[model samples]
Target: MPRLVAKGRSHFPFLALELLTFPPAHRSDFWSPICLQVSAAAFQPAARSSLLEPWCRSSAEPETRGPGPRAMEQQHLASSSALRDTEEPASCSGVKEEVTSCSFNSPLFQQEDKNGITYRIPALLYVPPTHTFLAFAEKRSTSRDVDSLHLVLRRGLRTGHSVQWGPMESVMEATLPGHRSMNPCPVWDQKRGYVYLFFICVQNHVTECHQIVLGRNAARLCLICSQDAGCSWSEVRDLTEEVAGSEMKHWATFAVGPGHGIQLQSGRLIIPAYAYYFSHRLFCFPCKARPHSLMIYSDDFGVTWHHGSPIQNLVTVECQVAEVTRTAGHPVLYCSARTPNRRRAEALSSDCGEYFEAQSLSQQLCEPPHGCQGSVVSFRPLMIPNRSQNVRDKSAPSVQQSPLLDGLLKPEEVAGAPSETWLLYSHPTNKKRRVDLGIYLNQNPLEAACWSHPWILHYGPSGYSDLAAVGDEGLFGCLFECGTNQECEQIVFRLFTDQEILSYVQKD
Candidate 1:
């Protein structure tokens, strides 16, 4: 018999059920009686035997060949245990009639808000002196005074408790011309200490039937700077003509074309921008003759750019690119986007963002089926040991074993393993729209480890709008809303560890 332990008093009726199994020889032992503190009027003697018999069954055969029955029972319990200690009325009729087992094998911490819309769109992440900055668009309804475009900062976690970085600043106002709607794509440049915000703004529009008819004005990429470590931001400046009028049109309303800017090892900055055309006139094909994702290179930062056509024979929109530095001495470019088939897909490139392979990896991610923005970042190794040997140990092995590794030593060890790539996108799974964070070990960039189970960072009635990682650890992400209502009024910036992300799926 198993024992029941109650830690505190319960104001409402509580049900305690325990299932235990013993060796066949010990089946004759009487289980300990569970103490009940119910009033005499509320107790019924006849119902006790039926409820207790299920808990008393110890004859079920354990599966020794595979996972034992206890392990299986624990899995069932963890997945089904939704009991909340509240005063809400219990709906016994809706509860499933099956019993679940539980185990304390895995642990995960998930924080979710029930009222906000979530987005998987990509944003620019930067860590300045006092705060972590995340820049993205918050799409709002057309009826509102202005479409919501924002740049939010949360306080960096340096000491004890973390706090919001800025006062949750908003950059969407009427003072700026061509600031009609929110732009979903933003990129940060730490070397130059600036953030390049790209968006498709509308001008020369007429109002029709209570709707503001928008025309394709020139797309603008604005550079905003914070000289005082993100405390005070400078006025936005136009980079369209400065970069030689490389502004593109909107392919899809949700598609913020080409927002990734990667500084390659060759000191050349490769920035991707797409050419798209949108018409509210509603033809047979809503999006027509849009050039696929395009790339442009700059030798002198953003002063000037050399344009390149879309890469040949690849079909994707709103693509993002990041450089992956393997533990080995090779660098690769990883690109992720929404496929033409409306699936979240990814591809790789050996040459610096100049050309990409036609094929994508086998494991498909749960991104928005339709076009949505996403971002990818390469994480640097946490610890790098010194290579200089002392004069006395010059002839010793180049690498020293950690003292913490008592007897766990292998003869042959793999060196220079590539750093893991974290892919953040919105995908629909288990009938719930969630933002799935997947980590791919870059042993072979084409095929990720089969054990790479994606975990849910946030889940609720809403989906993810955008994601950006702050600082060297690349743990926390600032997310945005996906809907057009500007429903994400309260900006939420969360800090999470990789261990916490993996624990969500491993919980027993």
Candidate 2:
């Protein structure tokens, strides 16, 4: 559900609102954010707020005959709303004053008018124990990914619905030394109380094309550790020689996730990555082609790392992984990656990401031409529907649903250490355009036909996204690239419940 904007813009200078649009001429009238700290009283309720008006009213309005469609809820969004963020969200440079946003989630990364950054990449990491969110982006001075971009970070405090974010700072600045540090893939070691941030450092002014044509892997795998939940970070550690070993000779280019990484239940730390392979012909000439998704894993909680066998045959890039129990009672590492042929490629690894048996292309999930990165998350709160419930729900045209429960759980899996696996994926909903972002739900990961989603987080320009579960609760928060007319304008965050996702079913 959408939260109401707080009053006192002058008193709370830390908030940079992406509210109802004004006009182009008055772009300077947009008051920038002040401090990161916000009082609890500053938060308002969503019901009586006028933040989202005219535009939001049509999409989320309710009918007199019934409550509302599960996909869209009707609410009279007011114009007098304010967005609360401590730092500059993946902010767009210019926005029309008439533009307004009304959704369950708001922008997390907004462009700063004072700063010259126009485009960047987004990555989100959530600490379940502390309810803290770490937002990472590759900051840039212009739209292109030249050798100038540096890694920047912002932290968010989630206490209930209100999230007070801190100011942005350059977290990793290898670019200052002439090399560019790109692609942030962060993973939390909940048991060890450590977070590992991974990235690749490319030589100064050397493009991926240059590395491919030379048939050499010039990118260096680097990592940094955080102990106090990102309050401080250790020095960068280069692991290219140890982890890549002789494999770098056959690699044109490689990098870890441009998103969040996961620590499996077995205490294994796996960072999703991919690389373009360099093929040497019989005449001793090297050639390059499609990339393959692979895993960089550390079995002893990031003490040491290794490169897993890449998923073959299917060309895949930028992907995410989750542990699921679709095969008998055993847990398998499942990965979903972006492809050029229009469908996302999925694979399962039995050896903790060491090797993968790639599944066929999923017709339900399509990959855009340029390929967009998607996010995957695993939580026990979700359950695959029983055989009978799926049939019954499909037959019924209209049915009332609990405001708190979706078809994610069945009676048998409701109690105990519920293990029936379900995976949630977030990506652009359309194949031809990067407009809508839908959350894909798959109960039977082995069966592509069993995949579906009931929630569309945003109906605007949305590109890449990362998903995180807040606490032990079924609540989820999404950090993604979104804008009014273009995907690169901003990076937004959204939180929703199972009920909100399944409320499409009529309420009793």
Candidate 3:
């Protein structure tokens, strides 16, 4: 581990990561803390990077795929094959008090926008090729989900020192006569080198309860694409039939994840979503019908989109999927979703999001009385050598990978692979309320017992979050809702190195 002794703390300032704690009154450290506690995994990043050569290909230059620049009106798209983020890294807006300082490192999207309103349900995306992070959210006038809301986005330019956020941009360039855009879910297809921003449009006057009672699918499936990262985007593609096919006639309405999507290594693009099931007969208002977690997948590099079957016997909503393992022989996909039973639900799929195995609840992930959305991302374990991939992060801590460790031995010899995959989940760690937004890591993702103590992201009232692994640089960024006194006074963004996360190890 890279030792940040009592004095060497200057080199590491991201531990605003450490200051992210639950109700200080609930801890003994609040009164007489002899020393600050940090997660062991926090320090594991440098070591992990040095040991595992991150297989993530984004750290390198982004290559141009299929087509050249897609010409669009009012869209200043750069070269299709080039990367762009024209800004310098700057420090976070200053806050004086200790409790509020945690947000000083990164704050991509805050409550105060051009129009004074709140921004909630953050969705973060890390495109390896362009090395850009697109932070998307619902610009709401009030905290209410159905209130006056529009979609706004900010692009984070990686300028070596810090993330420089561009001016907020409006996503709904085209206006429908009576529709409102909600649920901003994006999926990146490495093969086609495209980013699909999938969302749904519901009539402004029609809410979820209104649709259920009406027993009709008022939600329209729509999408916009960008060939050169997020710099420019196509006008918009309304795919109500192409995506849902005949399923639109079903009963209730559905929504895409308010977070990010995944492209399985097998070349399938999957977006976590849920829809209410109904028939021609309308269900009563306080609808007893449940929303089941499902996937909207694409096969031909997003040329065609299809919805996957929901997890049987489980009711889930607002979830994210990640490829836990993607080497030659054994491949597994992990899905984490919010459940109504006051807990998070998870399922594994061998196929590319078409069908999943059984689902189960996580004892560690506690949902509030009302369910909330959470985010998940997968990456190479910073430490332990995965016997399979035969590669590790090259810049982690102090590990010197000799030929033996890298599996470059005699011609015919084989190496051992990790039995499972590793995952990082972000949610509010508070048991009863949506407070103390923290992140948990599982070195052995398949085994719930292996989840590490949460590395707190922000204290106080916090809601909906999205996690992104920053290419192969042994770093990651979290875009979440946090405030000093309320859950979402602001939507904050913070970038963390593996070393800083180790300090968040639970105090056993």
Which has the higher TM-score value, candidate number 1 or candidate number 3? 3
Winning candidate number (TM-score): 2
Per-candidate TM equals 0.55, 0.73, 0.71
Give stretches of model 3 more than 4 Å off: 1-105, 112-116, 279-288, 326-329, 385-420, 506-508
For model 3, residues 83-135, the per-residue Cα lDDT tens digits are 23433422122221111112233444565632346676788887777667788
Q: What is the Cα-based lDDT of residue 285 in candidate 2?
A: 21
Residue-level lDDT tens digits of model 1 in 1-508: 4443322322111222223444566434533222122212223211101111111101111101222454345334334433222222212122221111121111111112322222222344544443444434333322121222333232222221222222233444212574543343444555666544554443323111011112233344555545444445666655555553433333322123323466666666666554433433321122233325555566665556555445444445556666765544446666665443445556555566666644342333444333334455555434432323111122334444322112322313223342344344333232212222233222123223222344433232222334444445635453432111122222233445544544443341
Error at 68, model 2, angstroms: 20
What lDDT score goes with residue 227 in model 1?
42
Q: Which prediction has the highest lDDT against the true structure? A: 2
Worst 10 residues of 3 by lDDT: 51-60
Candidates' RMSD to native: 23.8, 17.6, 19.2
Query: Residue 134 of model 2: what lDDT?
Result: 80
Query: Rank by TM-score, descending?
Result: 2, 3, 1
Better of 1 and 2 by TM-score: 2
User: What Cα-based lDDT does every candidate model obtain?
Assistant: 0.37, 0.61, 0.61
- Estimate the TM-score for candidate 2: 0.73
